[model samples]
Target: MFTTNPFDDDKLREECGIFGVSRAETASAIVALGLHALQHRGQEAAGITSWDGHDFHTHRAMGHVAGNFDRDEVIRGLPGDTACGHVRYSTTGETSLRNVQPLYAELNSGGFAIAHNGNISNAMKLRRELIRRGSIFQSTSDTEVIIHLVATSSYRTLLDKFIDALKQIEGAYSLIVMTPEGMIACRDPLGIRPLVMGKLGDATIFASETVAFDVVGADYVRTVEPGELVIVTNEGDIRSHRPFGETHARPCIFEHVYFSRPDSIIDNSSVYSVRKAIGAQLAIENPVDADYVIPVPDSGVPAAIGYAQQSGIPFELGIIRSHYIGRTFIQPGDKVRHLGVKLKHNANRALIEGKRIVLIDDSIVRGTTSLKIVQMMRESGAAEVHMRIASPPTKHSCFYGVDTPERTKLLAHKLDIGGMQDFIHADSLAFISIDGLYKALGETKRADIRPQYCDACFTGDYPTTLTDQDDVVVQNQLELLAERVV
Candidate 1:
């Protein structure tokens, strides 16, 4: 299927979004509303699981949440007072109905359902061991590993078994789990992924972003602290545990750059404010003169405004984006298919004609989108199109729940700034420095101390070891060595 946003093809995709609420009326409806607020996080599939005290009911669909969960019949079918839902883009698992979550299973303790929003770096290593030990598998999703681990743990209680499962995994995650006993929401030790707690009347809510809470008219309480597991029981008792102990937190830096909605709040900072700060930082670091400071469109708006303010350049709508387009269209021919890009974004030729405009974008991944956008600007009679990226160059693949291209496929990995400028055919191009990015986040330069955020895509300073990826590398080398010997 084709993407609705043509310019989004080269962007890094956030793997998933999760939401859960307990002690709420029509819990599945609340989950659906929350998931709609988080649609940007993932769009490939959506699911909601609700426990109606006696049994768990779920509806999983392979598309946007609107078409699947917006129907009354669908929400009514999931009868319960507590529910959790997920939107998935398949960073690790295959894209199929089987891989959609909240994945449910009947354990010895009772019914259990889980919705996950992150990647498990050691999943493949653990999966092999679980299979070797006779655990029957289901989906290929790394999240299923958590279920198997919990099922096989020798602990007496379900809570202990869940904690035991957490200890065996690595990498980033923020999960919402539902069982007969309670609803559990927790983050990985480093808190590489974000999860926030909110309140709606008597109900307790948990979501990947505060925006979800806002959508359902819930008040944001605070972030679920790093390494903390918060449980809201069937009896309405709320408890917290710091099972992983204290550890330095390293949340994904790109959330501020791209993943989150501008209206969301993360770590007490407004996402919109942070993005604007990033643009201001970009302007301070790379001053440019142009007729108009134009944003690439919605995502780039805040940054463009910040840049325009900082540089004293007038911001203009050089490109207009259409929000009404569907996810895909049947491509009958090459010419028609190429026009799909214009259906999403078209040049405002009247404003852009004979103007030297600076296009501000969040980030450049493979540079394919940037190239198309720049070419569009030129075709609109723009005298010169300068490009300013809000974030630092992405040079490494993300293993923490983001769908990223391989290292070699990343344009930043393959090319220097000058090369990228030429490749995108921009009159000039500049990206925020790594130091500038930290400064925007209200921190000192990266060189001055250990990094506070997971900027591994730019700096390659991974917060956790990637066992599965390393195993693949080692296997590839072993095969190469055998080939040489033969």
Candidate 2:
């Protein structure tokens, strides 16, 4: 079931986004444009694989799609009616060239290309079993593990092999595969990641978000049902199949809260409108007497507007984001990553000087970014910074797809509200109540089909238990870190 809590504060992390096209013309260019719309989900790497029913051509690079496939020669190089693309953000494996997806494998039957959005919780077990059968791995990613399993399967047909492979694996996965025959898209039985279909005249496209379909002037059809597989052929035939019976349809609610664009819709709900309602609910639940309601730029913009409208407080863009700030410069180093947020955002001193500020932010994952923002606001002469989070406190880690680690890595799990106020240097800290959050999104009923959210990170309600010793080791490491901090 989906976990809905207002006080559950956690920074929502995005996994990845996918786009695939099946048309006779320049499918590579169409995929490039579709990937551009879905780029908000990932930034680490971009890749596209095209097949012309005869041969497969692939292009991959470690940057935004614009720079990675910037040249016409690169796009023109891959000619095929059917193409699959991926924009990746590493939540599990090390961020490197080898990890860039659209992981392709060649077998005696033919070559198949695959791009996946979510993670498998039991990947270690699956990889171990495959290795026992003598399968060599080029990348440390769990996604590659799936391809290997399917390739070595006894099933003669690719679709049968795919079904057989999924039966052995457990956890969240929204996959798109390219075969010699056609294009295949499948979502996990739980549907933790978002995948939707669209139609533009005579063409059919599948993407991680509805925004991608909108870019190509395609009309939204519907979300790929949980435990369902969709196939699109070269002749423009679309087929849907549900092999798995009634399982939990636990779509990631965080997608509506943070990962997806406000303009996009997921699971038949408008993400932007739902987020605005969350802010409105926050204002009503925790009304603050402040001069102005300021948002933490970008992510907080929509919610801030709703909060201001609900509380009768003036809305102001107190923080401005600089688009020119390249995402690549924020390396893994502590000092470098810490300064990245500062370079990306700056406080509007002229508007905030000596004002009582009610700062709205989506979530505080590590608290580093929020701490920096609050300190910057104080330096800009803000009298007091009251932090209001739009979602609940994240107390656990998400193993499904998101990069959230063990409970020890979560600030809310380690510190109380008061301690968090001190750590962030905010005069006050109040998060939206979980009930109120669900009410705003109209997901108050626990038994509703689409109401169950993947609150594993916020509530520790992990859907699947980890059995691998290595997973336990990672969890223990986080526990040790938390103990030392306490």
Candidate 3:
């Protein structure tokens, strides 16, 4: 039996989702709803920690939010006026209940609960140093390193220590921390990860996406600015601080392409609109003669519409995806596994047969899915298959929050456009240029000096130092050498 999760391997996995609320009557319940809205970001584990003034209550489970937090008893177990929750897909830690977020630690000051949304690039180095200093760790998660840093900080106040811990960390983060004093929310200095603040009457809300606020009847306030911290007290007093000083914002461009929901807005731009713009740009760059423009389904829908509109090609649902299936299905044997893409998606044979089709998609990662998808279309008798990608080729692996395979595994990193076209068995393949991608974002072109967004996966201009990955490479090499010697 094939027990592996097939649906997740082809796409760039999202980092995590975080939701928190202060001064709500049923804060844990509200958090559960909010996490449900942001569930696409993660599916491995879910956790919530709430403060009932006198004590902190926590419940964490190694599964989806609906399975773990949908029950009344689960929500009732976490009674408090303030609560924070996390839905995690691990990038820097093993997938285990112990690695789940809303990671609570009782400090000398009081109980501290934290939920994180991004990767700490220097976490391994920090973990090694902290371990050498005799700091006992409860979890192998990189998010735990932040708590250790806060615990060892020389700062007097809890807030100061939290900020002190953040200052020492590198890479992306959108953190929601609940304390005995209040609830705190902050984003990284570069704004690489997204966090938004909102309000529901007297309740103050913080979530990874605006869609979460929409789910709980909360009005969107504003995005938590890069390097800015906002604290909401038990009495509903709000305070904002800028601790990281000034820095250029480089929000992840991939969020618009795949991670964020189409309904959500980030930095005053509609994600749906941005994706449409990307598709329009792709159409302008790579026009092709086709009978119909078809999306890969779901993620590619918006872009496919845009491409069709721009190219004067009729858009049709040439492929249908099954919604009832979970992310994975246990294949009974090789025969079932060979069914491949048909398990999740099937070509509308009547619509696709004898038609020259233009297929639109957000991004192609490892290319395994693309290969299978193309084969599916061919098997269904597509006369011609022209593949158009809305974003530039993803050549480098992401070291920030987004979970991507290594360079060796990336299709773009190993193959040029011609090579990819042959590999996927498509009649033609074209990806939007990097400059065209910036144009879709309303820029004339990408800035050569400092990019307006983190397109590192496309451009290889990483914004932060990748210290952990460097150490990992060295360790792997040493292990290989030792094996050879033995």
For residues 136-237, could you state the per-residue lDDT of candidate 1 as single tens digits?
888989999999999999999999999999999999999999999989999999899999999999999999999999889999999998899999998788
* TM-score per candidate: 0.98, 0.92, 0.97
What stretches of model 2 exceed 4 Å from their correct place? 1-12, 330-340, 445-451, 469-486
Report lDDT per candidate. Answer: 0.92, 0.83, 0.92
Query: What's the alpha carbon RMSD for model 2?
Result: 5.5
- Kindly list the per-residue Cα lDDT of model 3 for residues 1-486, writing each as its tens digit: 213366658899988999999999999999999999999999878899999999999999877788789899999999998999999888888888899999999998999999999999999999999999999999988899999999999999999999899989999999999999999999999999999999999999999999999999999999999999999988899999999899899999999888999999988999999899899989999999999999998899999998999999999999999876765466446767767677688999999999999999888999988988999999999999999998889999998878889889999999999999999999999999999988988999999999999999998999988889889889999999999999
| Per-model tally of clashing residue pairs | 0, 14, 0
- Model 3 residue 367 CA deviation (Å) reads 0.7
**Higher-ranked by TM-score: 2 or 3:** 3
Backbone clash total for model 1 is: 0
What alpha-carbon RMSD in Å does predicted model 3 have with respect to the real structure? 1.9
Clashing pairs in 1: none
Global CA lDDT computed for model 2:
0.83
Clashes of 2: 14
Q: What's the lDDT for residue 388 in model 1?
A: 99
Q: For candidate 2, what is the TM-score?
A: 0.92
